[model samples]
Target: MLTHLSIKNFAIVRLLDIEFSSHSTAITGETGAGKSISIDALGLCLGERAESNMVRKGADKAEVTATFSVKENQSAQAWLQAQDLEDEDHLCIIRRVVSKEGRSRAWINGIPATLQQLKAFGALIVNIHGQHAHQELLKPESQRAMLDESGHHDAILANVKKQSHEYNKLLKHLQSLLNEEQQRIDRKQLLQYQLQELDEFELGIDEFPHLEAEFKKLSHSQALLEDSQICLFNLYESEQGTALSIVDDALDKLSELVEHDPTLSAVTTLLSEAQINIQEAAEELRHYVERLEIDPLRMQQTENRYGKAMELARKHTVMPEMLAAHHQALKEEHAALEQQDNDLASMNENLDILKSSYFESAAKLHSARVKVANKLSKQVTEQLHKMNMPHATFSIEVVSNGEEKINSHGTDEVRFLLAANKGIEADSIEKVASGGELSRIGLALQVLTNKQSATLMFDEVDVGISGATASVVGQLLRDLGERNQVICVTHLPQVAAKAHQQMLVTKFSDKDITETHMQPLSQEQRIEELARLLAGDKITDSALENAKGLLQIQQENLI
Candidate 1:
């Protein structure tokens, strides 16, 4: 429901602000008045395709903003949440600015929105129809979508659609494997070669560091042996008293004194332990000095093995430490290839199951739609009777063209059919001959599909309609307004009479500027405006009387 519209520099509108009600609003004015201009500005704010021509003649740009009451629009609220937009209760503001240079900018709830986002939200908020058929009527998908909306099957269709896609994706991988069996066989051969190369030269994670440490020790063997031999000679075999032999001589002398003094016994025990430690150190040093032989061939062999391992590491694009993991990978790949055929067969079976599952789900959804279509046709027919469209047959039929098959939406083609008079063959709603007939059909669709509290705008809906038929259109509009807001730009006084509020769109021209303005009618103003609509350009006493009587009748209806 649109709460307000503010437009500036849009055509001859210049600046216009209008507040709306939750009831029927009929806007009437002279032929060149700004009613249509107001609609165009509102359309721009609704994210319609815009052009630089929309900008007023000397103005650099045009801006249009609409504030809507959208408390019931859950989908729109969800969209706003995703875009991080502010939603204050139910009010959503959409604004668009079109420059004279042809660039256009848009906003949603004060947060900037792309033209695409504005367009999407616009579809849910308002349905505007005028002298021309809606552009969405051209596409079969749009047609099907509208029909699904008529069926009220969005939630069920959404679930079925999601499950179907999951089932399809789940099955596609295995089917691909089944179809690539020959390729898998070739892949298996490559894996076998890699496996053999890795297995023949097994490597361990810690082996390289261990071997390198050992090699380093062996390379420095001569220097290490010399250092050890010199230290041993200084401690036990040097002329400075051969420390180990001195300890041994002291122990021998202390033993002799122990027989005479008890303190000498303790000194003799300590000297004996020192002599034993010196003997062990001398024996280790002598062995190291004897075995310190550098074998060049062994050193060369170790260097070659290290180089080979490093080269292999570089070849495999991994460090030498990862060789064990590389070997394991080759083993796994070889095993996988060995069982490739069985895996492929399993994949094929799974794909088949998925295909079957999707088809079953789709078929069930299609059946549900068929039932919904018949119900919709009957309900619409029942509604037509109230609109004085007795004997006016209506239907929604499904027709498949073996096309438009994608995995997302199910595969059923549907279209609306209509017949305006008795004994007439029902045909596409677009094929109706009379503008009045089209008006009534459009009215019926709008009334039947009033699932939301959205604002429905009709520009010149009462065109080519008058007499009792025009009165019926007015009644229909009024009833539509009872549940949802109806804003119609009408020429007929009968239609205008039904409005809970009437607005007069008038032109105000000046020497420098010619502009259009709209104002809600004061009580006396309504009488004059209705008279103008009733009697055309000239005012007469009988026309005023008729306009006043119409107002009185409408007032009574309100009572």
Candidate 2:
């Protein structure tokens, strides 16, 4: 429950501080007396959006602080501990500051926090029903959400959500497989073309060097043969006095002289050995020259083979030696493409399984929603009658137009219908319910669904009713306060008199500056304030008597 609130330099409020400890508190003030401003200031501490226009005329900034005693609010306490922002004494203080320049900052338990964090923590500690909550009651989504909350459909909804998530994942995987299949087709066509070209060339690893060598030898055969002949002649096969013949003639002369002188015998033996070596060299050169022939056919064959390999290498932008590696890579790619059909089939099967699971879960959720919708409509309609809207007929419509696609929210559409007056047929709540009816209906739903111990703050909930209707609204608020702390801002004396604690908001001019003041009313002060509410600027004796009687009746009932 909110224990204290402080506002400074906010709108028409200069400085205000008040403490509260009651099951039911009412804030009463004249129109334009800044009654709503106090709630707005509290909202800022709860992380509502802020603007520079909310700042006081002469102030540079506005600040608000709300303190909650969370001794009974375990959820809020646990959240503070989880966020590492818990105070030592289990007290939660939320503060918000807005500068004239539209800059805003927030803190929870004196620790800095983001606006979203503040809002989340605030939700755990209190539920503030703005004066405009009726506007939200008209939204179909809001109606569905409220129904789900009241129905306790969390378990079924979780199943639906899980199935939907997996279904979407399967859908994404199927799309990826389809995209890959198309890509594989393109890749396979390219790889097949490359492999066909490679097959036509009939290339091999290490073959480039051998082919080049053969081509070189065959292309220069005539030149090689001519050079070999000149070399042999110079060495021993020359026509002009062959070297072998010269050596032989010298040896014959030496042989004749060797008989005359025995020392000459060694010279004859040396000449004989030289002649034999020169003759053998001449014979070997003749054989080598015979083997060297000018064959244009063999040369052309080698040139064409080597030329095709080189041309293919250039076309593929690879070295002739690297062509074999490129061909191996293409083969591996083709093998993957061959396996694509199997992979795509498996993905499609999984996609079908996911769809079935999602539809099954969605069907269960839809059934649960329909069952709860009838009970919700009956209960809310009863609550509306209790709020003095006796003729108000409320119902939750759950319907499906065939088998709708599975969604996180399930397949059924939910709407709230209403008839605000007797003899009126129920219609869509948004189209038929007036603002006053909307407010009561919204309160009815809230009162029925809210079981949290957090305080409930209603800002001017009795906006369109007076007299008996206003009194019933007051009693409704009072009854709600019996279970949880409740604060209501109102202009009705009946509502104000019903509060266990009453606070009055009054605006007055001081030195040409308008200032707003708030203070908890004493017993006599409460009666005077109630009288003022009844008589407006003129508190007559009769109005005072009426205020006295209203307060007495509320007190007697409390007893």
Candidate 3:
């Protein structure tokens, strides 16, 4: 329940602090006295949109803070704990600040919070019914929503919504696949042909480079043999003066000289080593000449293989060395495309299953709504009789033919019907009800259907009601206050007289500034305010007595 509200420099309110009662509280003021300003300030604290125009003149910013007791509100407490914003005192304090530049900021329990978080948390604790709430009640969607809210249909409704979402998602995918079916077929066929060609080529890793090397050797075999023979003749097997023979002759000369001088021994040793190296070279050359051969057949075969590799590389728009890698990539793509085809084949079955699940849940939701709607109609009719509509007949029509297109809210159409007189057929409420009648019906629905919030606020919802009916509305709110905190802003004296507590809004203006002030009324003060409401600005003795009598009657009824 809302415990306190502090507003600063907001609209006509300069600085106002209001401590609310746990039961019914009435806010009253004369015309243009800014009675709704407090409600607007509270709305800001609850994350409503703020504008620079809402700031008081010459003020830099406007600020509002609302405090709520959460000891009994487990949902709010859980939300606070989840956000790490819970206080040790079990109180939720929400604050909002709007600057003159139209910028806004909010805090939950002194911790910085986003506007969306404030809205979500605020919804758990407060439900505010605006003056024009009946306008929304006229909408068919709102009617359906109200019917659903009256019952415990959350689980079934959630299942239906989930199945509908999945069904739509899959349907969209299937449609897209069907639209591009020809393209997919063409792509698959192309991939298959390319893969087959690469598979038949039978390329092996490192085989291309080795084949090139062997082909080079075979193509130039004759040149290689002739050059090797020439090298052997020059080095060791020359006919004029073989290098081996020359070295032997030099060694013999050096050997004789070395006996006289030891320095010549180094020369003789070098000549002997040279003669051995020349002989080894000549032997190796002889072996090469023996083994060397020209084979046209093997060379032709190698040439053909190399040419085919190059042709394939050019055809595939890749280098010869990258052909193997490209082949693997094509195979992978073809496999994925085949998988997509398989999925397409089974998509319809999946969609049908989802559709069946959605229909079943929606049917359950429709059945639940029918039961709730019957109870709601009976309760609302009883409430209307209490609000001076003695002969009013109210009913909620829930109809589903099972042939309507699937939607998140099931297939049922919910309509609120009303008949103002006895023996009259009830028609759609929007078409047959007057403004006052609509307000009464809208109020009845609001009072009965709103059971989730800890605090319920009615901002001038009794606009078109007065006299006995206004008194009944006040009593209904007072009854609701027994279970939930109720705040009502009204101009009706009867309504104001019925509240356990009353606050009066008075506007003061001078040449430079205008400000609104709100204060809880004392017993005498309440009498005076109620008198003013009953008899205009002039409060007569009789009006005071009437106000006192009204308060006395409400007190006796409470007992």
Candidate 4:
């Protein structure tokens, strides 16, 4: 519920601070006294768009703050928690500021917030029904929305929307596959040929590198054999004292001197070990040289195989090392292409299933909407009777278009039908009712459908209504306030008298500055305000008496 509102430097309202009750409150004033200005300022706190003109003539900026107590507003509380903006005291303060340059900012519970966030929270907590809201009944979308809201068809509507999305997705997928059918077949044949050619080669991951190494050795066999023979001769068989014979002579000299000096004995041991190592090395070299014979046939065969591998690599536009990976990719692509027909069949079946699912949900949604429409029509018609239209008939017409494709909100087209007189047949509200009748119908519908505890603000709801009917409208608002808060801006004394709380808006001028002010009314003050509403520009004795009597009746009803 809205607990308090503060508006500063907004339009002609310099500063206004007011507290609200949990019941109905009426705002009353003379024409041009700025009664609707309060509602306009409150709208800013509800995230409504603001213009530079909304700021007072000389003020730098305008600001409005609305405070709501959320102890019983579970949805609001949940939203607050979800946004991480919840306060420990369960109070929500929405503040909006607009500079003279048309710049605006908003905060939720002291944390900076986007305008969208503010609007989202506002929708959950308050509904401001302007004088023009009644005209929206002529719109088909609005009519459909009312039916759904009245029926509490959230779950069914969700299912319908989900099914519609799934159906469209499958349809698009199936179309794409069908469009690509011939192209996929051609691709499959090309890939099959490529894979056949690659498979005939029977390539291995490391075979290219090994084959190249063996080819180099076979091609240079004669040169390699000549070099190894020169190395063997230098190590053991050269006529100018080969390394082995020289080491043997040095060992003999050291052995003879070993008894004379201990250092010579160590030298003799080193020389003998060197001779043994040299002899072993010569024998291994000889064996290696013996294995180095050239074979012309093997060399030619190795060169031919290596050259073929290189030619295939260049044809495929890949390095020899990458040939194996490229072949594997072709194999996978061929396999996938071979399965396209089966996949297409499966998708077609899935699309059929999705289409059926959508229609089923659409039918259930239509049924639920029809049931709710019937109940709402009866309820609203009864309400219209109480609003002084005894012969008025109201109905909801739900027609299923049964189009081949579904829409986001299902296939039902809804319209509101109304008959304003006894002998008149019910017809579309757009063609039958005047502006005044439309407002009353809207009021009746709101009173019947609004079961949530949100505060309802009505601006000029009593327009074109007066006399006994005005009193009935007042009573309806009072009753509505029993379970929710109602703030109404009205010119009718009957409506003002019925308010549990009353505020009077007055305009005054000082020198060159004209300002508007609002003040809560005491009992005597309310009597004066109602008297003013009863008698335009003058309060007579009879008007005062009537105001008092109306107040008394309202008091009794409250008790």
Best by lDDT: 3
Task: Residues 1-559, candidate 3: write the lDDT tens digits.
Answer: 8999999999999999999999889999988999988788888988789899999989999999999999888999999999999989999999999999999999998889998998888788888888778889999999998888778889998888888888888999999988988998999999998888888886776777887788789888999999998888877777788778788888888898887999988788788888888889899988988898888898899888888788888989998887777777888999988888899879988988888888888889888999999899999999999999999999999998694677778889989999999999999988998888988898888888886556988889887888999989888888888878889999999888888899999999999999999999999999999999999989999999999999999888978
**Which window of ten consecutive residues has the lowest lDDT sum in model 1?**
399-408
What candidate 4 gets wrong by more than 4 Å, as runs, is: 9-13, 30-62, 81-89, 97-107, 111-117, 180-186, 218-222, 236-318, 333-341, 506-516, 531-553, 556-559
Candidate 4 residues 106-160, lDDT tens each?
Answer: 9999999998998889888988888788777789999999889888779989988
- State the C-alpha lDDT per candidate: 0.79, 0.84, 0.88, 0.87
Tens digit of per-residue lDDT, candidate 1, span 204-265: 75787876676787777777877887888976789878878788788888898888898787
Query: Which of the predicted structures, 1 or 2, would earn the higher TM-score when compared with the native?
Result: 2
Better of 2 and 4 by TM-score: 4
Clashes per candidate (backbone, < 3 Å): 0, 0, 0, 0
Candidate 4 TM-score, true structure as reference: 0.83
lDDT of 2 at 509: 85
How many angstroms is residue 486 displaced in model 2 relative to the true structure, after the best TM-score fit?
Answer: 1.2
Score candidate 2 by TM-score against the native.
Answer: 0.74
Residues 467-508 of candidate 2: C-alpha lDDT, one tens digit per residue: 887888888888888878988889899888888899988899
TM-score order, best first, reads: 3, 4, 2, 1
**Top TM-score model:** 3
